[model samples]
Target: MRLFLVLAFFGVLSLSAGVLMSGDDQDVDWLIAGGLFGVALAGEGARLWLRRGRAKSHESSGI
Candidate 1:
């Protein structure tokens, strides 16, 4: 699950960067890049929050 999340985050970053740096300033490209960025951020944030929650629970349970 962690590997999957990391891959997804990197995939979004790559796609966004590719589209934005393709020398095309079209509106659609911008929209796509923005969407990718948003998705990447959300994925990363969720992974971080979940990890933190799991660690806290583990500590509380003396794991």
Candidate 2:
């Protein structure tokens, strides 16, 4: 999970950089990069949230 989060964060950063470097929206490369970044970010967020919920439950159970 931690590895995934790191990868996703880096993916987003790289994609954002690509988007900024591109001259315009007509650039297919930049568009694809942006889409990949969005997916990575969403996946990371969902995983983190699920982990947090599980941790909370475990703590409440005195495990």
Candidate 3:
């Protein structure tokens, strides 16, 4: 979770940087933002899913 949060922070930073760097074109900025945000969301989702699986396994094992 902490790692995901850091990655998400970096993703937002990249998006903001892309926008700030974009002067004559916005398409590139949008693309950068989309990719970064997409990866961040996917990573966070996977992290949550893994955590959930771990919890279920622990419950089944009586641990």
lDDT of each: 0.71, 0.73, 0.77
RMSD of 3: 3.9
Q: On residues 1-63, what C-alpha lDDT tens digit does candidate 2 reach at each position?
A: 776768867786867677676767644366667777777777778988999999988775556
Summarize candidate 3's per-residue lDDT along 1-63 as a digit string, tens digits. 687677869787878977876777754577767777777778777988999999988785556
Q: In angstroms, how far off is 52's CA in candidate 1? A: 0.1
Q: Count steric clashes of candidate 2.
A: 0
In what order do the candidates fall by lDDT, top score first?
Answer: 3, 2, 1
Off by over 4 Å in 2: 1-5, 8-28, 61-63
What local lDDT does model 3 show for residue 61? 58
| Model 1 regions more than 4 Å off | 1-28, 61-63
The candidate that achieves the highest TM-score relative to the unseen native structure: 3
TM-score of each: 0.54, 0.52, 0.62
Q: How large is the C-alpha RMSD of every model relative to the true structure?
A: 5.6, 5.7, 3.9
lDDT digits (tens) for residues 1-63 of candidate 1: 976777677777767676766665543355556666667778788988999999988775556
